[model samples]
Target: VVVVVVIVVIVVVVGVVVVIVVVLGSNGGNVVVVVVVVVIEVVLVIVVVILLQVVL
Candidate 1:
């Protein structure tokens, strides 16, 4: 459905944004911890956002 597609797009966009923001802090352009943090943050944010959308 359109709702599912919207959520998927939002998640992908957030992931890309997180990666871009994090690459700024990596001198070697690669940091395991930063990658993990970005993933978790993105997942959490997306879940919370979706939940809020459903509740309202």
Candidate 2:
């Protein structure tokens, strides 16, 4: 049950970040900024998953 909740949260966060990236990309935002944001988000998701695994 905890694992399912964590997965759902991660999916939602990734989906939102992807949507933001698409919108910013369309608006001519910097490619470097987009890449950095994506990288940070991915790292966050991985960290959260790992922590949850240890806890549960």
Candidate 3:
């Protein structure tokens, strides 16, 4: 049950991040900025999953 809630929150946050990143990209975000943002988001997702694995 706790895991389900955590997964839901992660999914929501990821969706929001994707929308914001896409909007920024459309609004003249440089390639480097986009790449950095993507990499950081990937890292964040990995970290969260790893933490969840440990916790659960």
- Give the range of the ten consecutive residues with the poorest summed lDDT in model 2: 24-33
lDDT of 1 by residue, 1-56 (tens): 46855766777777777677778776664677567867776776687678768876
List runs of model 1 lying over 4 Å from the truth: 27-30, 33-56
- Candidate 2, residues 25-53, lDDT tens digits: the string is 66556565667766776776787778778
Per-residue error for 32 in candidate 2, Å, reads 0.2
Better of 1 and 3 by lDDT: 1
Candidate 3 lands at a TM-score of: 0.53
Per-candidate Cα lDDT values, in order, are 0.71, 0.70, 0.69
RMSD (Å) per prediction: 6.1, 4.1, 4.3
| Model 3 lDDT per residue over 1-56, tens place | 47755875776587568767676667655555557766776776787778778878
Task: List the candidates ranked by lDDT, beginning with the highest.
Answer: 1, 2, 3
- lDDT-best of 1 and 2: 1
RMSD of 1: 6.1
